[model samples]
Target chain A: MKSIITEPMIPKPFRIHRKLKETHDTYTIELESTNGADGFPFSAGQFNMLYIFGVGEVPISISSDPSMPKMLKHTARSVGTVTKALLNLRRGDILGVRGPFGSHWPVEEAVGNDVVIVAGGIGLAPMRPVLYSFISHRDKYGKIILLYGARTPEDLLYKKELELWRGRFDLEVKVIVDSASGNWRGNVGVVTTLIPRIQFDPLHTVAMICGPEVMMRYTLKELQNCGIKNENIFVSMERNMKCGICLCGHCQFGPKFVCKDGPVFCYDHIKELFGKREI
Target chain B: MNIAILECDHLQILLDVLRKRGYQVIGPTLGEGAIVYSDLNSTANLPIGWTDEQDGGTYRLKKRNDKALFGYTVGPHSWKKYLLPSELRLWKIKRNGVSFQIVTENEATRKFAFVGVRSCDIHAISVQDKVFMNGQYIDQHYTSQRKDTFIVAVNCGKAGGTCFCVSMNTGPKATFGFDLAMTEIIEGKNHYFLVETGTELGAEIFREIPHKQANEKEKCAADDILRKTAEQMGRSMDTSNIKDLFYRNHEHPRWNNVAERCLTCANCTMVCPTCFCTTVEDVTDLMSEHAERWRKLDSCFTMDFSYIHGGSVRASTKSRYRHWITHKLATWIDQFGTSGCVGCGRCITWCPVAIDITEEVHAIRESETVIGKQKTIVKEDIHANTGTLSGRTSFFKRP
Candidate 1:
């Protein structure tokens, strides 16, 4: 029983310090470990298995800057039962948190190279940390570009942050929506359509993409068409995950366990399995 | 390092030795309509004189002229039933006033001494060891059960209609992954079991049983039994570069042909020893004060196995069938460093429609269309030619 007590599946209690409504269906919650322990430092693109007391658990990416490990944050959509419960959580509410699991974006590897971050819908949440890391050390990388897309204007996450990032002269930000509504006056097309607007040195560019599988495929094709080698591209994948530590077999995508082997993978490593319709 | 011959009737002594040591002996028993693995208190429970005739989608127990203690190759149920149990309680959550408290399930306590494990099944257990123990996160429940298990492997004296361990290079003789290995030999009116110890635990138990040193003649009989079993294999698969075969043939039309026959019943996955996919089920009491999470066996053939946020990645029967066979034969090596299938042929026998994996792989291997398609795949992999594919890449300005 003592061995079971210390099992990896047993999540530690965390208090929701603050909860910000990101959109109609999504919320960004800041968490502080209840035990006051030195929290595990996580890298950009890693995820946490957030558990609602009596509901269920789901893998949500750490949307906050990785450098500030003490202030843990996650952005989740109210799509499933567990996530809906998470979105309803009030400040000081106790919840279970496990992980900071899976592979992270190669921010260190792209230090001297031009970094292109592409995301779609809520997919931008996982890419938020990468943008933070790049901007924090803006002098280390070359051209820093972010191309984001969503279904509509209302569906966009971190709208204020996008405006703040757009104000920065050092960063190149392009935002697009599939079906624009109201008095929206911006790029009204897929994210790939904005790729040509940003100038990057193809041979020295490192592209990191996270989105729907179809969007990821098109982004990879666009990146490769710009003379970006497959080895220089990375994509984050998603599957139904139970144990974030790779014990449960639900998150397998071919040979890779999305929870462990990647939420982030080099394009060449998974290119064969990528765009595979039946896989 | 001792070989001994125990008389047929003295098989009870072997069970008695294990029972005295507080090990609940589990072995094959004739149950309902077929031979299944279950607990055995005495030799009476053993499938004595009962030899199973097995084929794709067929199984029958027939009484043999000689009363052989271990004549069957393997039953539908495997040693995985004890190690990787179908239903396992992960944890229980109790309402602690306003907050919830988690209650972890205790580790397995029963010590198991498996009586009639086969070579292929032993390999299957080892394969699962790689999954449950060797992984980054250890399954404490599985480790506890596996650590307490004492294996008594039985060398196959005959092969079933679907048996293909010889092709997989796994069986017919119990070579490894066993505490004790035995070969049952019955000649004329005399019958005895030649036993050999594989571990110190097996040697300790063998010393307590009534047995004598086996001579050269008796050793020859044991070797002859295994030799005949190997030669009489019912099926053979060419495993040369099998990983590449499935990797290249994912789009082969043979999958569609097999999908027409596959019922998607998941019977094959349920019986397969190495298929370790599982899903978590959460249950709550009516009062909602107590809730528990149970891990249950899940099959790749299920419609929701590969489900994400939207829907299942593998929705069609063709994709499901291809995923199962290809994962077992190809991608498994990349994941676990070995083939997932031990070639027990249980999947072939237990399948309702008798869709043989060997036959499916053969059709893919023999397809002329796949050979032609491979050339196109090679060409498509060249980045320059596929630059304009789908017209989406053209949006990126060439620099």
Candidate 2:
């Protein structure tokens, strides 16, 4: 028997270029190839398998700008062991990175149409790149709007970037917090309440949403109520993924392998399965 | 050269020939009431004149009137155990200063000769080849084990109660993917093996077996036995546009009915030859100085199989059962360009509750036949009375 060595599961070494805390529990870590290799290119909603030595791996979305291919950025919450190990890393620390996998948000398909960005809490991380693409190419898309909701003021991510994006008159950004604590003056309700305050031509709008399943469900209903066609709405799905490729069968959502077929799927394609429980 | 005939008592010569070539010959042996595949050095280990009666949730061994070897359809054991093993170490990682270096295990060099392999199992192995070998990333372990193995396929002379390879287009006879193909011929007082070489290695091995040319009458008897086996298939599934059948009926009510009966024991996936899902775990000693990542067979029925950070995706047995059946008959064709099930019937016979996949498909198709009239009634009842939360509460109430 001839043994052929294959290491598709092995991760490549990537060094931390910088680390910045987004929220109290979330951190945005910038990474680059340790050997000065070419940077891993990825789309907005696609994810990378971040591997922590002696720990394990987790799928984190590439939250960095797609145009700048030299540096890779991932926003991770200290939710589990692997994410905790990643959060503990200092500058120049080495970790393994595999992929740039799954389907991306249809940013190109949304061109020439008004795009509605709705995100909840840490769910905003995957949508941050899509906002970057729309802001950089300001004229390609029509009235860009973002409606972000958080559990508390402290949970809001990319604070400085949100402030800078708000300064622009071309795009509209609305922020809401679930409950008030210290001089909280914004809207005090779920993300679905903020959808009515924003206005866009729903007929020509492409809505992209990412959040908890229940939150996404309520937000989807609100978007459809605003005359947004089911075909125009896209939602990012979450499932346990072992292999970013379609081999492991862990991330299967019906006929689709969320790791391969999609993390971002159009509403029409998955309308039958969106609110499905235990599936 | 031409087809050869081996007398019933001269089967020991072939075992000796394989052993002389440094091959560990494996064949069916009577063990603890069941015929299982194990090491066979002589014909005494063979389950001669023994046949098995199999049905959904039932199996029994019975002595046959004719003294013919390899008369049974298939046992609980498939050829997958020899190829894609249950557990294997993917790689060993040792902490080297700051970074770790991974050292892959050396390939297993033990050459194997698997005798009495059924045709459905050979097709099942080929289906796995499409998954492990023909894919972009080849499974190194499966590749090495497959390359060194020799197949001696035995054409079925009798079909079990659960045999259904004829419907899946796999076979009751060995069509290809074998080094040597044999048919057990029992006519009156004569019992012999019609051995046909499928490859150069098989031809060379046949030359050393001291066999004589099979005449026309012997060849006719061999073909006649396979013909009878095909006619006696106990179960069959309609594969005509089977992929679309499951796709259109993903939310059919039959899934809930089956889920009520399912225990989620995962016996079906364990016995299925084509269900190749797996998971990896990192194990270390108490001191935690060294860790080894081992890959083991996993079943889709387990809640941990679909678990992500927050919770399991397929938390309900209905969803897991739906995923298993749909993936086997429907979506598997989209992913691998072939059906995941080879209709081996291991799933049917081994399932504790006797949940037959063929029966499930028939139920779905029949439900769909009357779906136009029953659509509004089923939809309203599902939403008004049996919503997911209420339905889940009732599903778990089952004892």
Candidate 3:
């Protein structure tokens, strides 16, 4: 038992400044680091391992854009025990933040091309940064098309931002639901329906999609059918990310680490992983 | 490099010398119903005349004709039992009311000199090194245990029934990762160890020991014996295109076929030296004020390992087995830059069912085309490209 001492892993404290309920089960938490006034930096589509005092830790994506560095926002749905505990936290509660891990949307790569943003349910969280990046640099791209779908009208997230984007002529926003009530006046079909409505030159277009595996897979097929090359389409995948770094074997999808290699990957890079189940 | 010959009579004296030099010499000793690694003070404590006959789920010690100290290839246990301990306390947390402060225990400090390390064990250590140390998140516990350890590697004089180190390109002769390597050459009245120094410390040890320089005849004998052991390997895996095979055959029925027999007892993981999956647990006292955080080794074979919202992602045994096998043989190349398995054969020997990895690969290869037929039926209506969300989107909305 040789004692080879190295650097100690210290947990940094972050205070929950605000909480917003986007939907019934989903909530957005805005946190500020207690250690330094300078908040933790994170790109959209990257996640942080949030640790609760009594409960354990879980990986949650940073939903806010990189421009807002002072406050970190994580839009998470209450899925498991750890997330349930996280949603119970009121304003001014303390939590541990580990990383702003994984690759972000290639906004720089899609600078001069038609950018098509597709999101389903809570999947919109990871794409929020890329959306903001596009808005700030609106003149950089050609056509900006956003196709977002939720389970229901009530399940739709970022309604305020969606409303704001609807007023912009540079952006085209189409919102759909899987199932709708009698009072629902929006599109009443799958997200794939909206893909045909957006007109863009496929060869000069770069699409970024984030959603349920089923939804993303279908959307990817639609994008390909519409002439979007595999390399031009980027997708963010989900996995059980224990360690945000590449060590823990949980987030492994084939050779790629969803936490490190991607939460964002070219469709060509992970086309094989999408072929298999529980990769 | 130097070679030294130590007689069987002077073995205890050599052990004592090593012990006096501040080395916690650990070797085979009788412990817990089998020969296991333990602190040894003398040569008499070694399993001198003991050899093991090992197979799937069966291991028994048998008496050998020669009184050889290092005759056995390997047992169920490897050096990893100590280096990457089965159970470890990662961190402790104490709560005073609502506020909790985590107190980490200082890691143990002591220099260890493992005496009878086999080549496969060295490979196992290297495999674990890639997982624990070479990554962005270094495992402090494994790093601490491995840093100051000295190794005395022993070349295999005999091959076990479950041995396949040769096929994995790991064994028969100690290649690297050891301070010193020894080959025991005992013919008739001649009983001595031909020791070779691999490191400066090993050269220092060689300087202390009395021995004659090895001639060409002795070197040839050592080489011949190692070659013989390599040829005598009990199993061999066709590693060529193994990653590709697993990647391409995702729908292979062999997974489901093997899953029926696999009990998911996790014995394979327990014996595997490189399996480093862990789950964190939080324990609270009756008072509820005191809590402790423990990190325990976990296996993908368990249903709870893939637990997400509502249920487990891999609820069936077939999926779990597929995850482990693919991750080890195929996806590991992408993650760790090498295969996860070192071909130690401990997983094969320890598994309750004789689920040999070599056989499983062959089974998948042979049934690939037939498996494709089953795939068509198994394919959900969800477009192959999109996955399984075909007509279900409309049902997601509630009244």
Candidate 4:
């Protein structure tokens, strides 16, 4: 029998170490454990429930590298009440940290295969961990490619990191925008439009995706058209979650609870209900 | 285990014994024009000589010809109101400037002895066990309250107007999960209770009460009441292939029909004995000095239940109804390895619009041929709308 913690609902206090403005509305906040606990070890595509005191909690994906778990981090857009509260946090401001919950991307499983990571808008936050995992274990895979897109040139996240990865000779990083206003001399369209330009052995490739449901749906079709098997593709999902431990039932996606069974799932398993209305 | 027959007048002795054992006895009582479950300090508190008349969107308490303490069926209040609690203080926080320490709640101490629990409700408790107690992440309050709690199960002597435990194969007879199972038999001039001990604790408690060794005739009489209750079931459900039926008929037009009538008031979920969905609330003073987090009962029928940054996923009434019933009967099995419903029929009796779930499922099953034709049309429409990938935003439109 699995022995549960006496109080799973109670969160350990974590103080904000640093905050970075990623976009016009999004911010990434780094945190430190208040009690000097060990590093909060976690994998790619997992999310944490960040509780803003006196307000509420929201589930944000871990954006920092898994290799640097001590510098815990989460990226969120100021969309709702709790997220807006999250954006208002400054250095040393304390908040509650519940998890590093849900299933993670299969980086270990994709060690021998070519890796293709696709992200859109704020969705890049969740995929950043996967890219870091790939870089840390570069010799394990054949080829690594990153295809990221956003609403506009200004909406792209992790601008400095993208440029640094672009300079690397071993990795290929391609960025896109739906509509450009500045002197942008790059591919411009939806993220799926960039998928056709990349080259990887579909028979031995694993495509990882993290984005809004609509973007992921179109991307799935484009990746499948490139001969990538449904089983080889993975996607991260989001829903209204209250208890990140799967008790709240708000994050149910079809037969599975997105909080527990996934925030990351194999495309083949959820293909039937992925794009179905209101599911 | 032991079986005994106690006279009706001596029923007070059972309550007295349980109270002395440090249990807060809770049972059915007449309140708000219905037989509601509440704290029972004495035998007079039980709704004796009272039987409830239940049907779709209706419930009325009527006088019974015989004085049977456990005559009424389940009411709006379920055992969940005590076990899971409508509102629970999960934890409290004391803010000191920019940083604070986590403070856990006091340990739970009150032990409860639930009396007059029906057979179907006994099954409901076991169903919730999978969600709260027997899972990887256990609810702390649930584990504490349920640890040493006692259950007194009563076999139904007659069926309610909306009861269908026989259809779900849950009850009419309390076969297990009870400390004591009793069948109230009111023969001519002889009103006694044939009680059987189900556990060591039950046998110990049974020894403290006034009783006589029940003969074979008395045991057979108890079985006869359960048999009669089973035959008088007011409703029935087809359980075979239920999960597949729901998945195949997700887009069935019957959902729209039910939506037009469903108020989305969440009455069905509130009355359901096994619906365990919840949402949390954070409260604090104006100074933000002290903060508290409370877990409140939530339902899938509400528009806010599925809210995200953009909006509620299941925005339409039809989709909300589809999510609820389908989750209760189909996906819940896939999730928890068993159906969420125990066929208690409280949901049917409490709905304001009288939307019958069994009727809706029957409607879908009666017209399963519509599945192929409807699915094909929707698939064709999606294909036509988006001739190519990335041409359309969403292939699946709002229902």
Candidate 5:
């Protein structure tokens, strides 16, 4: 077998600079450019095919905002074979990155409109870039609200960032836990409960929601009940994507390829597909 | 295109002419209890006076009353078994310290000429071309093998028990995408083959064969034979608004009923001529310096086919089967601009449960009508504006 010398479409063997724990089961790793190569170019919601030498490859969304240059960050949970190997990586280990594949959150379209960010568990990783865009250009939007939920208080991610956003006068941050213990004092319900407590013009709001399939379905239904248009709602879909390109045919939902046509699609565009249990 | 006649006595001369052209001729031969596609050097190697009876996961060989070389409808083997292949080497990887380099190889270069190809198999090859060669990311191996191949298509003289190509608008008669097409007709004490050239290369071959031009009676006989084959089809799928019918019946109970019997054995996809899903596996040698990457055929019916971060998204057999059938019949048109199935009947003939797609679609249509009638009777009492508010509110409000 001969290696065809084509131009590299993705980054290879990027060195990890630091690893930080977001939760007991989750960790965020920061990667630096190897061989003095430029950092991978990617949109916020797009993901990378991270490969370990002997293990395998898995798709992980970029957690760090795109505004940060020369470094890439990914928040991963210890899930399968490839991911378990990724979690064992140290500060100076290397891994392969083959994307920034899939459609990104439409930050430019949400410009000048009230932005509602809803996330559950590790789903917040994909929304991190859009959140940074909002925080950096806070004057360009109307009102900004963030509603996030996790299994427990200790399971919450981005603890420092949540505290910083809570102290800001221009932003609203609401955190929820599915079940609570004695030490917790914040709201103890699902993230959808906080949507009704906040006040915003449904006509002027553009929502970016990422979560489990069941949670996103229920939240979209709740948003429609609040008079939000389907076009104004965006959701991220997770599937078994083998080839980040569209050749493998694993991640097809009806006519669209989740890896190519979307990972982020407007509710109006995919309503019929989402109606069924699986397509 | 020119039509020429090849008398039954001159069949051996035509095979010798093809053999002298430096092309490996492959056709139907007796192998493993049934007729299979294999290399042939002479006319004697062909399955003369032999035919096959095919059903779901069952095939049997029977002797015909007359010595006709091209009388069968189809067999378990299609052209894809040779062209696309079951397994292929994708690339080789070598690790140097912390970095890895991938090497892709070119393995196929031989020229082949396939004889006695059925019309449905030709359609299946055309459908695969849209996927492997016509797309943006071209599969180099498939392109290399298919580029220099010669196809001699044959019109079907009989229909199998599982044949349904007429309903899918694929075939019963060979129309195009072949270098040469022929229809064999046998009468009392006389046999002649009606041949037509589709390309310049086919014309060259026709000139080499000693034959007379086809008359009007021979053309009429060929058409009549094709019409009879179409009429004798064992099954038919309604193509009118089929995509919309499947879309509306996604939640119908018929899917649940079918899932109970589906074993998900994946034989249908394995035998299908156009199913092109593949999975990659990397193996490293004991030295750890050399690694080989292999691409193997994969199917949607497998549990790991839809494996995600947490688990399989399609955990139930019903959802997996629905995904395969709906994608093949409906959504594939939107994806690749053609239906995934060419109506080769391989799926029906190879499935362990004998799950006929035409039967499944009819069941869904009937169940949908029943469900529609039941819903209409309940519509008067149902509140359209503000019904189920409490249930919805409670489900969303739960912690």
Candidate 6:
């Protein structure tokens, strides 16, 4: 119950509204501001610096709808130290938040063309807001295709939402698992295998991909093979980020600060560095 | 806007005037056998008649035959230790029952009067200004310290062995960004400082100290000193096509060559005036009631600089060196619209194994085994022996 400070580095506290178990390793938590503030307004691909009370901070993308700003939802797998500490939090726990930072998904660029979204593993979380935007403005685009892949069936995030997206008539969702068992009745191949099955205008397609750097690297070739120009391909890149601004110098991928110049960059802009080893 | 000559006899009046104006006077003084920037309430604290010899992996202090206050090139420290600071407590977290409140550091600040800032370091400060002040988000701490600082920039009378300010187009002469720019002239019988006022406050302070209007003789003496310093440059690099040279040659053999000698000790970043990367440390009390967010200066050479879930992206020394050099020389232009290096040569002189950036660039430029252009990389001395682009305007100005 104190006056809020507006220094960019400081974090604003958000109370945990709810937490849902997405998978054995991944969980999606909903947060609401405890400090009598309005909704968090941010673009689809923007991320936030979530701070635990005594632990460190982690950069997680907002996975909820931009329209629903009061409730901020983040889907995270317990991968590192900060994420591991975040997974143990319960309801009513206060979390420090900064941003909705970085560049958003190129939803505007994809309008009036066929939109293809490719996600690998937990990469789908960053693109969830893009999906919300696309579904609302579904009439503005031609074909909408979502191609997602994971380690196995159990590792897939947002299974219920994936099913809902698949049931929509205007949208086409295709998922592939590297390998699966126990009545897993779906395609068992890499996500690139699904690129040939979808039907979209190659010249007019605007593809947005998010995933592991290796997966996105391979997807770039697959998309290019399908006659998608490098200019029309947009990929969300992930690097270790701190400060959520350009100051930390941690998230630099070549000339671009992944936190500032982009978390999302057009393929033409970063094509030179995309496949370069150890870059 | 007026220039004056302060006789060496009345130099203490300048420090006294600054102290009376409620400004902490920080200038070079002999500390641990090296000229260090520290508090000076009296003129006796100044490093009089002292000069330093610096080269790759070596430094030593020597005494000058004549008396001159600003006789040395830059040392291992910069004003950044005061501006952004080495360790800064950003905010304090206090746990109060179920709810805790955050308290940001908002204390009142005292003004600073930096007495002996060099031209290359002046450019270093300005480069940092572009990164911290002119960016999308302004750093409040850096801005607060920088805005009120009274800079007394000095034109270097001589160049260090590793100095390349002339090649970087940053110095030999202080161009802009200081409140006052001075030059030392230790002629046979007369020892005086030719000081030029660069701002209103600088003129006012110069007026308080005892000085006479600088005539053409004093002006020529100052200019001639800077002219000789420019000619005596120990190193130069071809910055004409530096961006392309670094951006295109990521896999150059010179990087692997430098990695073999580099210890990854991070001495270069520690001494670099323009390196502003920072990391935060969270310390909590035993009872877990109080936590403080402390930000410390970090270097790209550290293994944790690129740490992610599994490991670091730049795990090897080769990649870290590649990131440091490329970011400073090339990528900084893309991110900040300007190059990050000031050519002060701290990275060269402080490097334990003496890995020189100018030499590395020269080596990479010497053997043109570049990416993409798998076309023959003709080895040419195109950029060799160059800094001869005289009579041209300075390419790197303080943004």
Q: When only chain A is evaluated, what TM-score does every model earn?
A: 0.96, 0.96, 0.95, 0.97, 0.95, 0.96
Report the C-alpha lDDT of model 6 over B235-304, residue by residue, as the tens digit. Answer: 8988988898888788866677778888999999989988889988888889989888999999999998
User: What shift in Å separates residue A96 of candidate 3 from its native position after superposition?
Assistant: 1.0
Worst 10 residues of 5 chain B by lDDT: B390-399
On TM-score, the leading prediction is 4
Backbone clash total for model 1 is 0
Residue range A153-182, candidate 3, lDDT tens digits: 999999999999988988999999999899
Tens-place lDDT per residue, model 5, A140-244, is 998999999998999999999999999999998999999989999988989898889887789999998999988898889888888889999999998887767
DockQ of each: 0.35, 0.30, 0.23, 0.60, 0.29, 0.46
Q: Candidate 2 residues B314-386, lDDT tens each?
A: 8899989999998899888877888888878999988899889888887777666555435665787777876
Q: Which pairs clash inside model 3? A: A3-B109, A178-B393, A178-B394, A217-B386, A218-B386
lDDT of 1 by residue, B1-399 (tens): 688998888889889899999999999999977889999998899999899888989888999888888888787898888888899888998877656788898764799999989999999999999888887778888888889899999999999999999999999888888888889999998898899899998998888888889999999999998999999988889888889888877786667677788889999999999998888877888887888888898988988788777888889999988888888888889998989999899999999888888877766665644455655665776845553334332221211
Model 6 clash pairs? none
Best candidate per DockQ, number? Answer: 4
Q: How do these models rank on DockQ, best leading? A: 4, 6, 1, 2, 5, 3
Docking class of 3: acceptable
Which residue pairs collide, candidate 5? none
lDDT of predicted model 3: 0.80
Candidate 6 accuracy as lDDT: 0.87
Lowest-sum lDDT 10-residue window in model 2 chain A? A1-10
How big is the positional error of residue B70 in model 6, measured in Å on the Cα after superposition? 1.7
Provide the global lDDT of candidate 5 against the true structure.
0.82
TM-score, chain B, each candidate = 0.91, 0.91, 0.88, 0.92, 0.90, 0.92
lDDT of 4 by residue, B185-304 (tens): 999889999998899998889888889999999999998888999999988888889999999887877887888889999999999999999999999989888889999999999988
Clashing pairs in 1: none
